[model samples]
Target: MDFQFLGGASEIGSLGLVVRDQGRTLLFDYGMTPTDPPSYPQPAPPTIDVAVLSHAHLDHSGMTPILSRLPKARLVATPVTLAVANLLTRDALKIARLEGYLAPFTTNDISSYGSRATAVDRHGTFRHRGIEIEFTPAGHIPGASMTLYRGAKDILFTGDLQTIPTHLVGGAESVECDVLVMESTYAGKEHPDRKETERRFRDKVAETIARGGKVIVPAFAVGRAQEVLMALASSGFETYLDGMARAVNSIYLSAPEYLRDSKRFRHALDGVHVIEHPSERKKALREGEVIVTTGGMLDGGPVLYYVGELYRDANSSILLTGYQVDGSNGRQLLDEGTMTIDDTTIRPMCEIGKFDFSAHAGHSDLVRFAESTRAETVVLMHGDRRELLRDALSGFADVILPANGPSFTIE
Candidate 1:
């Protein structure tokens, strides 16, 4: 089997890969970088037989519509993933237009991709172009998956995996393969213990509320927003849900089986106030409340509105609950003590806190996963600490750090 790393090789975003065997080519995850003017992967081969999407995140499925232009392309992903991808892709197009940038594809292209999509169940095996393919739950987000290809040599692609179970999704299932292509997002980093982290988060919110100050949690609309809602609800807090998260909440409710506890998730939604109008959002801001909004990295969304409103209040708190990529407003706030929203920059007087509510496996978890798989070779991607992971797994397997546009053959 010949594997080519088209993108997402040394960077944390814009993941794309191509696999060729027996005169058939399969593409895996054609995504875009999450930058101001979001760069994309190299042009996809003209005659891709199958394009498999691993999840709904823009960095993993953003460029999928490009494949729609190919006459023989057939898209494959889990049902929920495909649905969420549709939502995210449409949102990306809107963002592109709002930012005055040229979108890579049109709504019609997304529709065409949807028309060509085939939904597969998690852990189900299917044959395509004489190659055996299977998907296992990746535990990163709802419908995120790890793709397994069986040909001359068995290969596994870990697409943004998380082995630790969260309120929304269960832990990733372990699998064995000869060559393992895995994400190293937090390969050498250790997160705070889950229970401790949750306790600290709840305590902070409680303290803010007690002080007659509002607690604003900036989260990703898809997975992190729901997780924050569930966490707050479980901790006996009445929260407010706003922005694109409301739409995602509806989608999550529609697909109950994808979550860890559907009933609990529904209960969380029941306990929260959903902000449906601008007026309602303004009203919520007048009182001391816990509010969760979209745009986790603070790139844009209702978070900007909340930040602008709360920045001057020293008693108010803004909690960031995810990884802040470099150059994002979230990172700027954390590193430089200021946030830029549009043309205006503000140094908020509010208390700022960052929590590790990440959906990726940490150092110990990555080591456990690597040792469990017992693969002969482990290829690390999607992170900057490849050397750390290589050193950690040196005795367990042969480690290979690959760059973009290179082909590695598995023996």
Candidate 2:
């Protein structure tokens, strides 16, 4: 058996890894990179026999629609992942529409992808030809899973996952294998206390509101948005959700039990407002409204319209509530202090703050996880820190970090 890291070795997204024995191949997590070298191509004949997914984050799962066009392919994911993946692909298409980027996969592609997928929700052994596969729950996203592939040689594929469990989900059981293809999203860092972060997040939202400013928060449309909404409600503020947020919340409802506070999920918007389109943003801007919008980076959403409307005002606040990946407008604004929205250099006059409510596990958690499992080799991916994983790990020298496009022999 041999393996290749098509992506997700040096970077945190576009996580693709391939494992092969003879002519048969198994790819794990077909993700798309936000920063485009315009890489990734349509697979040739024989193609990828089966692709396994861990979660629905775009960085980890976006390229599937493109790859699904290949022949004799089957996607294996959980029911919850299938539901969320469908939502993500559809949303990706919408985001692409505004950015002038073509979606690699069409609705039809997603449909076919969904059809070929065999949703499994169990802890058992499954066989494909002579290869043995097993999936365990990965506590990153609801229904997220890690797969173990056993053939002549044994290996595990860790999709983007959290080693330490959070309120929304829990981590996977680290199984023993020759190669552990794992994620290191928060490899070098430590996540802040959930209570502390939520308190601060709430306080910031309230402070901006109390100052009579529209607290513009840009969040992803999935888990983070719901998390922020719950935090706002706990903080006792009226949250005004805009863009695809309200739409996405319905999909979130598809897995209410997956949430830390299921009842709270439904009522987070009680005092809050929901803006479906750009026109409704005026009222939120003219008057001080705690507005939550999609396109988390102020890219291709009503947030940009609101920023254009109120960024000049120092009194306004922009609370960034998630990871701002590089090159994204959110990261540019959060890091550079200046941005060109609509070809205008809008120096960030508004107060900008970031709250790291990351769903991924941090440095200590990863160490704890590795130690608790007592796994011999821990493969790392989905992180920018190469040296961190190497230096921080204590007990293992076989922690493989495969560079993208590099292949490895397993048998």
Q: For this target, which candidate reaches the highest lDDT against the unseen true structure?
A: 1
Against the correct fold, how does model 1 do in TM-score?
0.97
Best by TM-score: 1
Task: List the pairs of residues colliding in candidate 1.
Answer: none
Query: RMSD (Cα, Å) of candidate 2?
Result: 2.7
- Scored against the true structure, residue 334 in model 2 reaches a CA lDDT of 77
Clashes of each: 0, 3
Q: Give the alpha carbon lDDT tens digit for every residue of 1-411 in model 1.
A: 777888888888889889888788999898987589878887888889988889988888999988889999889998889998899899999999999999989999999999999999877776765867899999988888998888777778889889989999999988898888889999779989977898899999999888878999999998999988888886666688888888877887888888889999998889888889877888778743888998898889888898888899988899999999989999999999899988788899999999999999998898889888878999998888888899999898999998898798767
lDDT of 1 at 254: 83
Each candidate: RMSD: 1.2, 2.7
- Write candidate 2's Cα lDDT for 1-411 as tens digits: 677777777787677777777678888887776443333422323588888877777777788876567887778877777778787778777667666787677888988888888777636456676767888877776677778787665667767667665555555666666666667777678888888887887777677777777788888776677667777775555567777767657765776655545666677767677776666677666654677777776666677777887887887799998888677788888778887777777796889999987877778877666655555666777777856876766456467666777676644
